[model samples]
Target: MEKVIEMKGITKVFPGTIANEDVDFDLLKGETHVLLGENGAGKTTLMNILYGLYQPEKGEVYVNGQLAKITNPNDAIKLGIGMVHQHFMLVNNFTVAENIVLGREPKKGLKIDINKAIKDVEEISKKYGFSIDPKAVIENISVGQQQKVEILKALYRGAQILILDEPTAVLTPQEIDELAVIIENLKKEGKSVILITHKLKEVMKMSNRVTIIRRGKVTGIVKTSETNIDQLAELMVGRKVNLVVDKEQAKLGKEILRVENLVAKDSRGLNVVDGVDITVNAGEIVGIAGVDGNGQSEFIEAITGLRKPESGKVVLSGKDIYGKSTREIIDSGLGHIPEDRHKRGLILKYSLFENGILGLQHKKPFSKGIVMDYKAIRKHCKKLIEEFDVRTPSDEVNASALSGGNQQKFIAAREISKDPELLIASQPTRGVDVGAIEYIHKRLVQERDNGKAVLLVSLELDEIMALSDRIAVMYDGKVVDILDRKDATEQKLGILMAGGSLSEAKREVKDVE
Candidate 1:
């Protein structure tokens, strides 16, 4: 195999931290190589050094086995390196073709050749099998489609070594499978790809070679065929890890959360959650499974008191909580792990200690007569950070500075700390690494075992099957069916999620509940 690029003796430092330390990495000419590490494990720093965002203190870079000095992004691009960030950088008002050919637009006699650019974009889309509509505006397209536009941008700029950073974190499972196929197609066209992700499963299945990094050092590099998931995990963590969640049979008790004829509407007066009824019993987890937009958000919002139901009852602990404020619901023994951490979970600018005590600040040991006790708050955050294994340099750090998984763990630690009777854990492991996913799952199940009622909502069916005692399939503004984990197959659950029937599965859930 021909080496396209080699990063030898790479060392990068920031204020109070060494981001990358004496790292050696290589990318082949036509291979889908993977960068595997836990959150804050120097993966992004190493790639940024490669792409010229950071100047290494002591290192050398090579392009096609020739030494090169990349001082900026433009220099990296000139060396046939293009990177697509986890968040898409595109003008929403611009058309897909326009976004793709923004800088390198085709022009005719001092005028932008709009038609030619569209034609070129369409050709590239078809050639790469990306299936993007060049004329569609970026704001109107799905995340998956917008990603195609980003790839098209790289392709238009004549990039051979493409870097994708956590590209599938926000995509649906079906979309992830489609992305895998597209990657295969890219490889078939002889384009080398470098995927930076923490999901071990994707790395195991997609990459030809995997490089594991931990604590600013290269732990190991192994061929994908020769490395099992366990080996990769151990190398990444510097210790052995159990990939599967371990839990015994749940000893479920009486219903702690009951929903009767739940009807909720969006701002447009559309019935997003219509006539749904469900129950979550003590010491058990009942997961609501669905795609991204099919009433799941509204259902959780209504139940958690973010939005009041149009006409229904969200009975928590035998009391109607439909019209209560979020704070009141929290006071009423509901621990909600919101889906969007930045939007609803925390104030990003605040320190981790402050954010951890936001919802519980008024309680004793956190506050005293409208004055927050700073020492107590710091103590709380420090304890949870150590207990939850959040990979922050310190608990006093700003919440925004942490990585995705660390932010997630911060939220998880706070929610579980509430020690509420009924917990609403929504998408607890989304955007986290596989190791962190296993850890979070263990924590949630431990909560369940402590005799708490857990109402879990997730888009991952595998997660629903793994953790939930019973699964409620939500589709098109209704509770289509609920089923036990023992009898629910992926095939049946998929059909029910798309508004099909799960008759036998429903019978078992009803009997158990």
Candidate 2:
């Protein structure tokens, strides 16, 4: 196979970190190559060097068999290379066509040619088998659609080599399926692709070859046809990873949290969570399974005191807490692992030790009436960093400096350390690597075994099935059905997630059987 892109001896260094070390990578002309690694494992750094976002201290880039001198994104684009970042770079207020052609606009008599831009977008979208509205505003579109616009933007710039960074991080199962189809179409069009991800399933399903990176170095490269999940995981983490979550049957106890007749509105003042009723008992995990945007976020926010419920009774340890402040709720034994760790969980600018005792700043040993015990705080945070296996150079660094997995580990450590009676973990392992997921899963189960009530809200059905004792399917802001772990299957949950009745889901499962 002909090589479309190659990086030889790529070495990139930051102020205190060697992002990539003597890395060699190559992409075949029409193949989907996966760059597999854990968070902070140098996958993104290598791709950034290739995309001209950063220059390697020691390396040579060969584009289509020729040495390339690419120093900027424009240079890379001119060389027929494009990259779609994990976060979309589209202007939200502009239409899809406008965003796609923002830099290289077609012109007509000293004015931007809007009609031609739309036509060009439509043509490229159709060629790629994508169904996107060229005139639709970016803000009004779904995250999945915004991703499509990013891809269309790259195609519009005549890119033959595409790099997708963590493309499926925020997508639903159906959206992931759609993206798989889109990648297939791109492959059929003979465009080479580089998929950067920590997901083993995606690598197995989408790529022809896989390159594993760990601790800033290449560990192994193998054909996807020959490698199994276990081998790939071991290579990526440098250890044997227990992919399956292990836990014994739950020993149910008294009710820890009860939500009755809950009704909540979104930011636009529309009812998103409507009449949700559920209970989490001590020593059990009650998983909320649903497609994204089904009022799950609102329901969690309402119960956690992040948002007020219009009409509901949120009782924690037999006390009403619906209208209580977040701090009060926390003081009342509610530990929340918010979905967006950066926004709700931690203050990015603060040092790790400061964030470690964030909510507890006003409490016992760490502080005494406005006098914080800095020595004690540092000792406590250092223990947490070690206990949770947070891979950071020092606890004095800003929280923003840590990788996503490390930050999540820190939050998990802090929340679990509080020993709250009721722990509400939302998307706890969303972007974490397999090793971190293993650790987090084990911790959640350990909490459950220790008689803590856990309310888990996740979009990953497999995760829900693996961790929950009782699974509650939410649809259209309602608890459509709740099933025991033994009674649930992916087929049944899939039907219920799409708004089907419990009986209908059962029938579908029966038909499948």
Maximum-TM-score candidate:
2
**Model 2: residues with Cα > 4 Å off, grouped in runs:** 108-111
> lDDT of each model, Cα atoms only?
0.87, 0.91
What TM-score number comes out for model 1? 0.91
Tens-digit lDDT track of model 2 for 234-266:
999999999999899899999999999999998
Candidate 2 weakest ten by summed lDDT = 504-513
- In order of listing, the candidates' clash counts read 0, 0
Per-prediction TM-score to the true structure, in the order listed: 0.91, 0.96
Q: Which stretches of candidate 1 lie over 4 Å from their true place?
A: 92-95, 103-117, 135-140, 265-269, 307-309, 503-513
lDDT of 1 by residue, 1-513 (tens): 899989999998766677789999999877999999988888887888888888999999999999999999899999889998876789999999999999888999999999999999989888888888889998868777888788889988988889998887767788788889888888887888999998788898789999888978898999999989888888888778877778899998888999989999977789999999999999999988987778888899998889878998888888778878988889989998888887888898989999988789889898899888899889899999999888877877789878777888889999999999998988888778777888899989999999999989887778888899999988999998888888787877887877777775466457756
User: Candidate 2: lDDT over CA atoms?
Assistant: 0.91
C-alpha lDDT of residue 40 in model 1: 81
Q: Positional deviation of 146 in candidate 1, in angstroms?
A: 3.3
